[model samples]
Target: MAFFDDLSHIGFSTKDFYKSTELYEKLGFELIDQEDNLGSKVNFYQINDLILEVYEDKTNSENGAINHFAIATDEIDKTFAHVKKLGFELIDDKIMHLPFFEHGISYFNFYGPNHETIEVCQKNKE
Candidate 1:
């Protein structure tokens, strides 16, 4: 079966985490999940079924407005292998488990030729 399921969320890079998050809140979006890894912070907000993922960035050299877009998959290992076979180098190739979640979320982000990042993830589901 094809590993990919659906589009999970789209990520944006922001220098000011609280400022941007507040802006989203004013737009009727509410914080659903957030995680701080290393020095980087990732946040997920949702309005109805739409999800927007944002991350803190100290240095964003790219002019692109998008940081990365996530694709959901049921079989993350197979999906990761497929992306590897396509010759895309993965920046995140390990399991990332959050304290609030049960299963570990496995994912990888690869830079396209244009330097835009794309992520395929298998979310922790019961």
Candidate 2:
């Protein structure tokens, strides 16, 4: 009955991208992917099966916290509809796409009970 496969990643906002990457690397996280999209640079790191996302946020003045978390879903459209039917406040008007990995990723965001951002994404593949 679960719509998501697993917790795909957790994101952190950083004012200094390079400095944050270096710090995460020292903490045993290996950089897996990087991209320049969404008006800023994003880097994905992995330590075992965990994917941690760090993205540039120059306007962020305070020390960062978990910006958002993503849940992996194979059936994006179906899940999106289900979430909508459940009446959760959706952040994205429609599913959004980004060139993230081998192919790309399509996702949408909705606010949780506490107004926390929760992203449901499907990583497109061949």
Candidate 3:
């Protein structure tokens, strides 16, 4: 089945939230949303259909980088099944909603063979 319909957003782990926010802003992205997540600040930016989500790295470690990207899907159940059939390891098989957004978003993450985190999600129609 065709699972992912489009690229939703890219997630990034950064040492400085405001600094990273400024960088993306310099690149022509505007801040669209922000929320507290896991003791870190989650910032979402947008430039048309392209989006970037940056969250502070709690450990402030050297691992700060592009963490993951979420793909928009209409059929969450079928996507999960197909991703599993392809042998990707599920991180959490549960659908999660973002409290920051007024509209609903249901998604789950799975790790590729190389451990790259990817998300398949059903986001509200705009």
Candidate 4:
């Protein structure tokens, strides 16, 4: 079986999250999800199967650099355990949850060999 289902989304940390999201909207990306918590705001826009996650980060001066990329999984818990068994370092202590998509999503991140962030996530089914 495949470890991941598909490419979920690409995330960007920007100094002006609203501006970036607005630009994407004007380009025909439809806003699909948004959330605000812990003083951080994130917005998701989709064009077909491609999703773009934009979040505010005043400290991030680089406006367009990719913060991370996510791979979708149907079994996030099993995937988390398997990745740890393979000795991949976990970025989060445990799986994290977000009120995203329909029923929400569970996710976690690990650092690649080059220090790039890669997230594995599963969108819950209602």
Superposing all C-alpha atoms, what RMSD in Å does each candidate have to the true structure?
A: 13.4, 13.5, 12.9, 13.5
Q: Write the per-residue lDDT of candidate 1 for residues 58-109, one digit (tens) a residue.
A: 6876733576666567887776777677666567666454444476676777
lDDT digits (tens) for residues 72-102 of candidate 2: 7789999899888867779998999999999
Candidate lDDT (C-alpha), each: 0.68, 0.77, 0.70, 0.75
Q: What is the lDDT, from 0 to 100, of the residue 19 in candidate 1?
A: 67
Whose TM-score is higher: candidate 2's or candidate 3's?
A: 2
- Per lDDT, what order, best first? 2, 4, 3, 1
How much is the lDDT of residue 59 in candidate 3? 67
Model 3 residue-pair collision total: 0
Model 3 scores a C-alpha lDDT of 0.70
| Global Cα lDDT for candidate 1 | 0.68
After superposition, which runs of candidate 1 have C-alpha atoms over 4 Å from their true positions?
1-3, 67-126
Error of 3 at 7 (Å): 0.8
Error of 4 at 20 (Å): 0.8
**1 or 2: which has the higher TM-score?**
2
| Candidate 2 worst ten-residue window by lDDT | 61-70
